[model samples]
Target chain A: MSNKVIEISNLGKQYRLGQVGTTTLSDDFKRWWYAFRGKEDPFLIIGDTNDRTKKGSSDYVWALKDINFSVNKGEVIGIIGKNGAGKSTLLKILSRTTAPTMGEYKIKGRIASLLEVGTGFHPDLTGRENVFLNGAILGMTKAEIRNKFDEIVDFSGVERYIDTPVKRYSSGMYVRLAFAVAAHLEPEILIVDEVLAVGDAEFQKKCLGKMKDVSGNGRTVLFVSHNMSAVNSLCTRCVYLKNGTVYSIGDTAKIVETYLSNESNAESCKVWDPSVAPGDSVARIISARVTDDKGLTIDHMLRDQKVGIEFEYEVLQEGHWPIPNLHVFNGSEEYAFVSVENELEYLSKKGKYRSVVWIPADLLNDGRYVFGLALTTMKPNVNVHFYAENVLQVEVIEDISKRNTSYNQRLPGVVRPQLNWETTLLSD
Target chain B: MADMKTEPDEEHWDLVVKPKSSLFTLNLAEVWAYKDLIMLMVKRDFTAIYKQTVLGPLWMFVQPLFTTAIYTFTFSTSAKLSTDGIPPILFYIMGQTFWNYFADCLNKTSGTFISNSAVFGKVYFPRLVMPFSVVISSLIKLGLQILLLMAFYLYYYFTTDQLHPQWTLALLPAYLLILGVFSLSLGILFSSFTTKYRDFTFLLTFAVQLLMFASCVVFPVSMYSEKVQNILMYNPVVSCMEAIKYSLTGHGLFSWYYLSFVLLVTFIFLIISVVIFNRTEKSFMDSV
Candidate 1:
């Protein structure tokens, strides 16, 4: 037995497209009239899958469709999806805030969600009063809140002003107190969505630490966020959602890679968005990527292996030998190398172009590196068309097991070269 | 399909979500679990309202006090309505406290959706706690108003021979019980209607005011014609109010017949209201 806590099968949620849900009152009456006579729901027959990009024929759309996933005890699972991809809707259903339109999910523990912090906080209530009120709202009994009362006050760091109304507290103090109350909640299954965006960096760090502590004690956590790094560090596995359905669900790194790759504004590879591209109307970088020797984009590369840097851009009014420049820098703000595409001068069309620059293996030291890219005209004033700072980052690692060098100790300098090194002892 | 076998091994799951629950299932255990929320909501209503007000909870008594004055001026002196020969202030205070409690419970509950949409939208608790807490808070206010009535009763007892404690004073618990149940059920029923058709909320305001005239609030039923008396006697609030009056001031009727009739009506209303409330709780957030 996996000690499963949640099991969802064929789960779906169909929502009406706009404000007026499920047709007009007259049509709803007709639908109800038909249902009263044992006929199928007339509207349900016409509803379609929810894809907002394209106009569908039906007025009803499935916000979540045919989703199936089970969660075991103590699993810290990250739910990552684009906006309107039904991430919130799924959490809503799991938290029982709303009923599912189709299918069912069985949850085998007390479930709580930090859909929003400090929910149902009365402004007039003191910080101490709100703690108890918010705790009870999250399903903690009075005795449970009392038992954790002192610990809660201590964690909030507003012990001196606990008796003061929360409206009098600063925004940071408000968040600390709100987070402290939520942090004390220890349900068997916890669902958190994007609440970490609040508070300062230090408080955010504290909350993340608190969450780590909670999950460490074998509680199932369902976290949803667009912050991929946080998810990568905290989540053991990830469920990648696309258009209201599970696209993939697997190890956190792989799922994050797939999810980021799908995004046009990825950390390492940015497929051009017309509205957000960095260049003028003439020419723009459409997409950029850090790839390995196999020509597949990767987030990290072994330092001993050669890697390819590729950029695909469109030259609208082509001319002037617009070359793509690549600047590689290690973590210490030192440039490892710089490369610019050497193109034939002033000879290009008004169409798409692909540029590839390969960096050889065993040349750079093992460290975190970034690619700062620029598209510049090679003539006249040497105008920079687009200069994207830190456009992509890659981690280079040297595996000791795969190395043939006798030198295992630390070495200096920004670059590691497999150069010829031999010693001759003639006097001996 | 193989995962279904795990069900037998784990019979201690705390929650189970399904597309549908049995229609008749009250699921009172779920309601029982949220009792703290109910109490906290009661405290919220009590304390949150008086945050900036100068008089604070003193307003709870002042409300019924002024209403009694208006009823005494308009109904006693202006309309020459009889209060079973009891003093006007004491009689009106007697009826106003209980009726105001019931009316406020119903009125506030009628807007449960519009007022608490914030709390309701983000969280999942037994939605009945909202209306239940509304009644308890109003009940607390009523308790305060009763203290005012006691002061008037004591003055009338010493100054004149108009007040006397009857054996029926022992039935105060039953009277409050019947009144509380009847008001809560009726309030919840109206609250259910407001969720679907908000037009009822406007109607509820004026309708409650109009119903108060037909009720035994300002005057005792003994003063009305027998035909009118029998009709007003059917209202549970009428018998409950009359019993409270008879217990304290030794005026008005306190018959088992009226008490049993009110009990039956309250029981039926309770069942119907609970059914509607549970049904509304499922998807009220959708429309509301």
Candidate 2:
């Protein structure tokens, strides 16, 4: 016999995206008629897969399309995607929470899913009762549950509140108990969604440890999350989805790299026009660009090189306001730094000002970053001018050979600028 | 390291390890396997009903007793309905006890999909377990109410010295069987519909109350005209209530042919309900 626990072939799921009314009824009839006659659905031909993110003319969207993969026994796979990328839909289909519109899958083991916490818990029932209820819902027999009941309660750390109704428990306590029952049930296959997004950091660590132990016991797991670091640490393989189709599948590091790079490339900056940007009082941002020191257009830059942003705008009136602000964001769309021209003080005498903001050499660390600019009235609590988002792109590079930084300083966060450091042996 | 390289054995496990067909078959063995869960659900429903209440389980007896008293006073004396030589209290209590079982089953079962959508959306089990648990839970209430009816029956039997009570009481099990079939089928059927059109949920309680009067819960079916009786017999619940009343006091007449007709109709309804429930379980979360 084969060791594969799940074999899926050409799995597809389509959904109608609109209010359920007469129009949908007629369309459903049409689709059902074609399906009855063993013909391809006529509506599926409207939009190509290349532009799935764009709103289509039809009211239907395929949530998953032609997905094919196989999972061997004991393999833990992480599924990653942005919002509306069909990651949840794929998990739902595999869990049998919903059926696919087309294709098939063969699952060779008992599957338990922790899609959400407190799923099977009744508000009026005690925590002790909910454990058994949730376990049975996951297909565990009473004797099997009885054998692990103490372990579940212990892992949950809610022993004192075991007989108290879950309704009174805090969300953290509830999730801890719920996840404990799910992970301890010992199913042959486990599916978990982003339920770890709840609970405290310490609880998240505990849940992750339990998941690792579960996968270590020769059971298969399919995990879906947006946390790249956790995915890197937990999964043996990774699948990246984009607009309901498998974009790539391979090793976790390679797949994450491909997904992140592709995401940045797909969001290529668009030219700005005053009419397209929304604002009330002040002048709007007409255009913005990033360039090298030689004034040549550049998308990527070295970590220790100079970078410049040129802002072009048309002033609505001669005003003492219109403070231009620049914000820089790291690859994950987190704001890295904000610089305001309010300190220039020279711009207070300007009319229809155009200027460039420059960063000197040897400042940023290695990473991709996007730049945004806004032209707003300097006064507080007032609606003003226009803002342009993700207008300029910059990339920083690192020399892999250099290894002087301490371990604590290597992690990525909101700040990546180098700072002066000195050490002295004072009393020795 | 050698133990780590060895593949885990799959044969020793009792879990269903084969690929399931999209069309699920009723696994009677699986239900047998999860019987403890069914028992737990039943216990939860029974004990939790009056958990925070002052009277606790005593309220179970009090509810049926008060309903029977009001029903005897209103239907027997005020409406002047004939009890067919049986005491009014015994006649009404018999009908009310059986009818409540049917109503409880229907009301609870109809809300099965909506009520358990959270659990169903998260995990996979025999979805049939939920509706089946409702039937089992309602049976507990039925058993309690029947015990109260027995208490009233003994009091009437000893003090009034009612004749012909022994023979009719022997048919009580058959009456309960018929009632069980009727309620289970109706509950599953309504549950399937309510999963789609939630408007039916609001109408369910009022529908049950209106159905109680038409099924002879408070009055005898013989009190109505023959035309009304014919119309009432078309309702499966009417046969169940009439069967229970006839079996308890030996008052109303019994018809095996009509009871068989009710059984056949109920069988067809149960088949339809199971089929719809199976299909709905696959995709109901989309609408819910």
Candidate 3:
């Protein structure tokens, strides 16, 4: 038998551009008239491509257009895209909460989607009642819920408050209980969209583990999330959507690398005109750049080589004692570290200056990173003249040839430094 | 050949979703498959409404009782309208009991899309489950209000000899089924329309209120002229209310032709409304 569980062919969804009522009655009549004559909808050919930023002339836009993909029985697919890139629209179509405007899809088994957790949970109902209610809303029979009632309660860890209305439960307990009911659902195909973004890290991990266990039993899973780390760990295959279309689909690591590199909108250098630069009268930023050790500007960094981040600014006034600082963040927005130029003294005269910080090799894990530049004064209540966030971003690629081990998995951490180690063979 | 082997026969796939389906494709099996969700929704509607209340489900009786008292005071005592020889309390309570059920079902289910947009936007089941469950839950209140009517029935039965519940009383369930289907159809019809234009929602509430006077809830249909009675029978609720009142008190018009007219209108509207509901549910998220 074929293992393919879902096959979507040329699926597309078109949406009206403005308020739903903006479509005139004449337009609806015209479309209906076309269809009544056994012809295609006249408006379908007039929609602009999906781009939320651009204001198109047409009143209809294709939120998703000409999409084709399929999923096997046991594969976990991650859908990654920028906001408004039709990720949610695609999931909604698969979940059957909405239908596409064109094309079709076939599924081989039972499908359940958690476009959101706690979908039908009523606040006035007790936690126990909500479990059964939400489970039924998720398509579980009453008897099926009864069979796993105890397990669901145990998993939620809210047994003491099971009989209390969920409105009285703390937010964390509510999510835990809601997620427990969903996790116990035994559908053959599951689609989750960012429900794991709730609760604390430990609860999220537990939910991920339950999903992994579900997939381990040969069930198919489709996950959509902007958290690349979670996607990297959970999804075996990745589908990258760009501007409401499938840009690539392949192995998880390869697609994730492409997505992260493409997401780095900033280049090695960003220069602003002095007249409109970001700063006050006392100081202003002129440019920011990322460079290699040889002083050549580069858009990316090598894991085994040194890199430098430099900020150039003009000081229009004297005696401000402005302090230059840089904040580094990893791909997941985790704070890496902050560096300050404490060794430089305050310049008594007005002039332009450049501050450079060299990042040691092996200090950053292989992924994407962003830099933020700011100029602040420590004296007189610590005033900041200007702070620019995400001034520059670059990708850190690992050099496989320089590796000392055969391990090929991505090392987890915000910072990966080569610390000194002393090993002695005392027995010999 | 190998690729062809991997792709199974068209009939093997369990579910196939399309953009549009025929108007007659009602999918009663899908609704049947979601029966558990229907029952759970019924339970939620019943239990959630009475939470934090002083008397809880007792309010079901309180509402119709007060409404009957007000109607009797307004129509019987003040206006001196004829109750067709039945006691004003018993007559108004009987008519209001069935009328309230229809009105309640219509009002509750009319907002099905807008009120439950949160749940509908995130999950997929048979969207019809909500309106179906609303009708079912109101049946509970309908049962309690009937008990209140029965209490007045016994009081008048012992104190006076004006009671004659005929063999036609056996048709009470049939009338209720007609009433339920009628209101549910109009409810969902308004719901689908309101999803796109909110005017229907505003139109529904006052329309149902105005519908009560035409349905002869507070007065007897006998008080109206022959031509007016003919026009009133076109309103499906009028025949149902007349049949239910006549069966209980032997004081209202009950004709098979009118009942069948009500049934046919309800059945046809039920088909149209359900089709519209199904079509709206597929894409209402974008508009709602």
**List of chain A TM-scores, every candidate:** 0.72, 0.82, 0.92
Please list the residue runs of candidate 1 whose C-alpha ends up more than 4 Å from where it truly belongs after superposition. Answer: A21-24, A39-42, A265-428, B1-12, B220-224, B253-255
Q: Per-prediction TM-score of chain B?
A: 0.93, 0.87, 0.95
Query: Per-residue alpha-carbon lDDT of model 2 for B1-288, expressed as tens digits?
Result: 244249653533223222224454656676777777787778778766766789888887887789878987787878888887778888877777788788888888888878888777777667777777888877878887888888888888888855355365576666666677677777776777777667788788798889888887776788888888877887777876676666666667566777778878887777776777777777777776
Clashes of each: 0, 0, 0
**Candidate 3 residue spans exceeding 4 A from truth:** A274-276, A280-282, A300-304, A316-321, A331-333, A343-351, A366-368, A378-384, A394-412, B1-11
Query: Any runs in candidate 2 off by more than 4 Å, and if so which?
Result: A21-53, A265-270, A278-280, A312-326, A333-342, A346-350, A354-363, A374-389, A399-428, B1-24, B166-171, B198-207, B224-235
lDDT of 2 by residue, A1-428 (tens): 66778876677776766665112556769979998999987876654342456868766667888888888899999999888889988888888887776677778767778788777677788998888877777778778888999999999999999999888999889989998888786778889998888789998999899889989999999999988778878999999999889999999978976776677632323455556754544475666678789987777777667888887776665554667788887766667798877545555453556778887766665767777787766665444476677767777676644535545344566555566789888997
In DockQ, how does model 1 score against the reference complex?
A: 0.47
What's the CA error at residue A244 for candidate 3, in Å?
0.7
How would you order the candidates by TM-score, starting with the best?
3, 2, 1
By TM-score, the better pick of 1 and 2 is 2
- Please give the lDDT score at residue B171 for candidate 2: 66
The CAPRI-style docking tier of model 3 reads: medium
Question: What local lDDT does model 3 show for residue A351?
Answer: 92
The per-model lDDT (C-alpha) reads 0.82, 0.75, 0.88
Models 1 onward score TM values of 0.81, 0.86, 0.95
Per-residue C-alpha lDDT of model 1 across residues B55-101, encoded as one tens digit per residue: 99888878777888898999999999898979998888888888888
Candidate 3 residue A48 Cα shift, in angstroms, is: 1.7
